[model samples]
Target chain A: MPGETFKEYVDSFSYGSRTDLFFKWLKGAAEADAEDYIQSLLQELGEVSDTGDLSKFFEMTYEAQLAANSPPGEDPRWKYEDAPFTPLSKPLSEMRVGLITSSGHYVEGEPHAPPELSDYTQEEGTKHIGEYGRAKPFLSAVPIDLPQEKLGVHQPGYDIRAAQKDRNTVMPIDRMKEMADQGVIGEFASMAYSFIGLTSQMRLTREDAPQWAERVKDEGWEAAVLVPV
Target chain B: MSVGHISRAFETAGTPTVIIQSNVYRGRVVVMKPARVVYTKHLMGRPMSAPFDTERQTHVLREALKMLETATEPETSVILPDAYRIAPK
Candidate 1:
């Protein structure tokens, strides 16, 4: 049983899988005004790929993470427009609230928070999310009036379709686009919130939620809400 | 589908389950188990194009769950067609 080699580790994911399009803007992918920045990334690393040090992987992980954590607001990696800036015409009691959480998958040796709130303090995760319970009211209201299938579209990234682990994931995104294109939105953006994986301080989410919030705003949704979990 | 209906189905079938809908983002297969289930693999990236192909995602999830064969209920596949659970988990 030879241990996994550095080359083997790198081979696990394709550039598309490993690369963060939002975090790293390449000139090609999503329209003009975009360019690949891999050259500088390589030059900074001395363009050495075969480094056998596993620690380099950790360093790279952290470096990529840091770049993601504190990115510019104007140039966000999250792929969503701001939620429309309309304060909920209906009060919190009247409007439906959506809760987005951060604890989903916690693989072996992967990062995860301890159960207790105090553990978050010890873990220093509270830095990004001040209080987890602030979002309770919203979480409490889920699976509300909206049709289960229609509401399913809101939790786009969550395992909406995994009802039996035997079929597909939620309302198809392509389907959603078609629905939206077909005037699915009676008067508002049909999809309210896009709950991209909620690793609060993580890069992907930092880009995901803010864009969702903005999308909620831009879409003129009453409130594409989220509650800390 | 209500989480209750999902849970009841599993209960009646007599399996320990985490019945998540791929569209149920909070409990989506990708979000719940991103490592096992690839994101993009979901229906042409209907959700997001982050992971692999849908067939590949299903394959990986099924395989990963297979590892828990000895474990009770044999971790089930939560992702499925966009339909309602007769009951909620």
Candidate 2:
């Protein structure tokens, strides 16, 4: 197909369909020559379009991407047949709650500063996604009293653009305080916890999380709200 | 996924935790199994809603907090009705 024809063909599909097609093309191009892959993809697209049944095609494309992106050797995701539960021993109005976010936020002078604040260029941010499973996991304790102006997010796993404009998008410290003031909850914990969500899951679950639990217990927080980016 | 694991660890350590997450990973959340989960249709990074949307942000937070008192069993999940909107660039 000619370039204009191809563009017209893609434009005919719905927004969701076009996105699925784009990802399919992206995955194919990664393994084959760009020009050759486009020709084959166009032929397949034409076939699928004619059938008016793209569900199977979309499913296969999703599965292919999942398999291609999954880490080598055994599923990396954690699974537990029995999830542990601990009911609140006190009323909501009497319990102290804490905030935990995987938004990779930290104060400007904190020890766990993200690369973006140091030397990583905007282009480098895109490259940082590959560091997901390898990055060292660490936690930052953000004082609830700290000014929002000092807060900065370093999460590369997802778009941090919204967060950069307003930290409350991920960490609703101010809103939590308002709730506390209104007696929705007894009090907001003095410190809010945070860490980069794109780091090694194994290290986070086994090493860092247990310690964080102990810290929460030690600090006398009754419950916590976990916000993931 | 990290949040799910951390919430499990917290519950195991005897500190109750409730997760406020994006619905995009609902399947993953189900498998990882946190004690209580409240999902919002907000975009991945802006889980509480768009930037500076205090009214919507508080509403989401309040819903998650309510799960602490209301969740009676493990793996209890709630899906909020809020729809995801594209964040301004």
Predicted complexes: DockQ each = 0.02, 0.47
Across residues A1-229, which tens digit of lDDT does each residue of candidate 2 receive? 3455544444332122333322432332233343444565567688878885544443344334334334344333576788899999989889999999998788877655344333543234435445655666757889999988888777656667777787788888899899899999999999998888878888888888888899898998999989997
Question: Can you tell me the DockQ of model 2?
Answer: 0.47
Highest-scoring model, DockQ: 2
Interface RMSD of 2: 5.0
Q: Write the per-residue lDDT of candidate 1 for residues A1-229, one digit (tens) a residue.
A: 1595433333332222333222321212222111222334454456345553333432343334333333343323222222111222333323322222221222223223323332442123323233432221111112222443333221211222232121123222232233234442222234432221322334333243344444444444432212111
lDDT tens string, model 2, B1-89? Answer: 89988898999988888998877567667778789998886654677887777778888888988888898999898988766543433
Error of 2 at A188 (Å): 0.6
Candidates' RMSD to native: 19.5, 8.5
Residue B44 displacement in candidate 2 (angstroms): 1.8
What would the DockQ be for model 1? 0.02
Give the alpha-carbon lDDT of every model: 0.28, 0.73
